[model samples]
Structure formats: C-alpha cells, structure tokens
Target: MQPISPIGVVRGGRRQVHEDGWGSVVSRIDLDPAVFDVSATSGLDAYSHIEVVFVFHLATRTCTGTQHPRGNTDWPLSGILAQRAPNRPNHLGVSVCGLAAVDGLTLTVHGLDAIDGSPVLDVKPYLPEFAPRGEVRGPAYAGELMRDYF
Candidate 1:
C-alpha cells in the first residue's frame, strides 16, 4: 500500500483550535500538488473543484466511536456507518475544496480543514460525469446543527 505524508498546512475555515496548538478539524480539505503531481491527467486544470481525502492523525490515539453529531449531547449517539464523525475506526475525512490555482506540482485550494501538519491521503479530479444527482437524502440535522452552533 502507498503511504502519504502531509506537505503543508491549509488556510481557511474556522475549525477549532486544539490544546496541542493544532487547529480544529476541518469540514473540508485541500491537498498540495507539489506532493500530488496531478498534472499527468492533462485535464486536471479543467475542473474548478476537486475532492480531498486526508487522515486525522491526532485521532491516532483515542479517536473512537461514532460521535453524536459533532460532539453535541442533544444529538443521539450513532455508530460509525451512521454518522460522519471523524472518530470512526479509520479516522479519515474528505471534502471538496475549490482549486484557486495550480502551479506545476503546487496547488492552491480553498475549504480544507486540516490542521497545520495533518497527513494527506489522496486527491482526485472531480469529474461531472461521475457526479451523483437525484434527490439528496440524509440525516435531518442541517437546521439543528445551525441552531446548536449559533
């Protein structure tokens, strides 16, 4: 299996600041091209957006159990497959970050939530052909989360 190490920190988003000086986990992610080398595709630049996958290294220790919706007590505790909590058995996170620029192997993207030195997993060009469409269905918490946060 191929291993991936983090190249640098991503800016943007207001993830929480951790006690260890690392910022809060992000709801999104941006990967570095200097490390990714997506240029081989030739059409990588054609897409304005792409998805990022990264590891939650901090969770390497006690990251366990599917959480109750961002650690809120009001939300019911759920299992790994039920919710998108990072504390799952794998501790991996994925998000679609907007590509601002791509210079050779160096890429600039927005909306990544990784801390200053988190490990990156992989990057893929988001193709519309592969996009999923249809009435989106999921948990009934978009409004609940907003109220809980605000």
Candidate 2:
C-alpha cells in the first residue's frame, strides 16, 4: 500500500507520555490550514469525544516480530499486534479522547495518548453506534501493561 500524508500536527502539551494525568492533559490538533477546510469541523463539537488516528512519528524503529511489551520481561512475550506498542510496522496509533473544544482548524482534546508533534492522519467524531456490540476481553498481561499507562 502507499503511504498517506498527515492532515495535521499535534501541539501544545507535554512532550512525553506520562504514567498518569492523561485525563487532564490538554493538547491541540492543528490541521494544516492550507489544505484542510475549517468547515469540516463544523459539527464535531456536538460530540463529547473524538477518535484520532495518528502516526508514531517519534518511534526510533519498527517491530515486525514479537517482543516483550514495554520491555518488561514480567509481561509475556507477544506479537506487536497483541500489544499497543508504538514500534509497529505501520507506526499508526488511534486514540479516543474527550473533546474539550474546537476552534477553527485546531482541536483541544483531553486524554489523547500521543506525544507532541505526532502527525494526525484523521479525526472522526465518536458515535455510540460505532462502539463494540459485545463484551470486551483481553489477556491478563495487557491489563498489567496498562495499569500505569494512562
């Protein structure tokens, strides 16, 4: 497949991910004003949340095979897809965050799990109908890894 261009860049926030405070951490997704139409975000504020698809632009390398999650041996080894590791083949990340506000081509959001300067590929309003229909389940190790990732 061909690569895609970023619609915008993330800004105004802590440069690194923290173990906590994501709920209160505020950041901005600034769309490329030249290519993106501000009107595209006209009704996005109606939703309380948004799904941001971004690129892990800061990842130093790509992982095409299995590796310990977070480099913690205590967690079982698993394929890249089994964990939310940033070093994936495509280096893509999707985060659902609370929509704090929207101003023109800039969006202020809370709980976005990406670092500063991350390239935003797309932004979709969060809708109830798109949520999972059944109970969500995952491995025990996945829980352990996320215990402090928030």
Candidate 3:
C-alpha cells in the first residue's frame, strides 16, 4: 500500500506531557491552504469537538511483540495493540480534542496530544453517535498507566 500525505502540520506545543495534565495544552492545526479551502471548515465550529488523525513522525520503530506498557514493569506485558502505544506497525494517532476556534486555514484546539511539527492526516467532527455503544473495559493497569497521561 502507498503512504498518504499529511493535510496539515501541528504548531506551538512540544511532545512532553504537562505536569498539570492535558487541560492546559493547546495547539494549532494549520492546514495547507492550497489543498484545503477555507470554506472546508465553515461548519466545523458547530461541533464542540473534532477528531484529529495524525502521524507519529518522531516514532523510531514499530513494536510488534508483547511489552510492558510505558516501560512500567508493574503493568502486565501486552502486545502493542493491547495498549495505546505510539510504537505501532503504522505510526498513526487519533485524538478527539475540544475545538476552540477555526480561522482561515488554522484550527485552534485544546488537549491535542500531538507535539509541535506533527503531521495531521485528517480532521473530522466528533458526533455522539460515533462513540462506543456500551461500557468500555480494560485491564486495571491501563487505568494506572493513564492516570497521569492526558
């Protein structure tokens, strides 16, 4: 399969997670004006959140086997798919962020997990119907690992 090009680049924030958590993080998704028209996001503001599909441009390798989550030995060993690790076969990430505002070719978002200079593959409005239908379940370690992760 062929690879896809990014539609935009992230700006302003670094890859590091904040000590205060994701609440204070903010970043801008600057789409290529040539590829995306300003009108493309005209109705986007109607939604409170947007889903951002992006690439882990900084990821070095794909982890295919089982490993501890976040290198924490306390967490049970699991395959890459079992956890939301960035080191995957495909270095892609999807984050649902609060849509702060949309300008001509830039989208101001809150709580976007990506770092500055990350490549954005696509953007979609978040609809309630698209969320999971039932209760979400996971290992107890998953909760502990994400306790500080935004």
Per-prediction TM-score:
0.67, 0.92, 0.92
By lDDT, the candidates rank as 2, 3, 1
For residues 1-150, what per-residue lDDT tens digits would candidate 1 score against the true structure?
866466434544444433221122233334455664555446667878777777666674333555666677887776667764566677777766666666565556655555544556776887777877877676676456544221
Which 10-residue window of candidate 2 scores lowest in summed lDDT? 16-25
Candidate 3 per-residue C-alpha lDDT over 20-83 given as tens digits, one digit per residue, 9 for 90 to 100: 3765688899999878878999889899999999988888878999999877798889999887
lDDT of each: 0.58, 0.87, 0.86
List runs of model 2 lying over 4 Å from the truth: 1-3, 17-20
User: What is the Cα-based lDDT of residue 42 in candidate 2?
Assistant: 98
Lowest lDDT sum, 10 consecutive residues, model 1, at 19-28
Q: What would the per-residue lDDT of candidate 2 be over residues 1-150, giving only the tens digit for each residue? A: 977889999997769755456666789999998778889899988999999999988888899889998888998889998877888999999989999899999999988988899999999999989999999999888777676655
Instruction: Write down the lDDT that model 2 would get.
Output: 0.87
Check candidate 2 and list the clashing pairs.
none
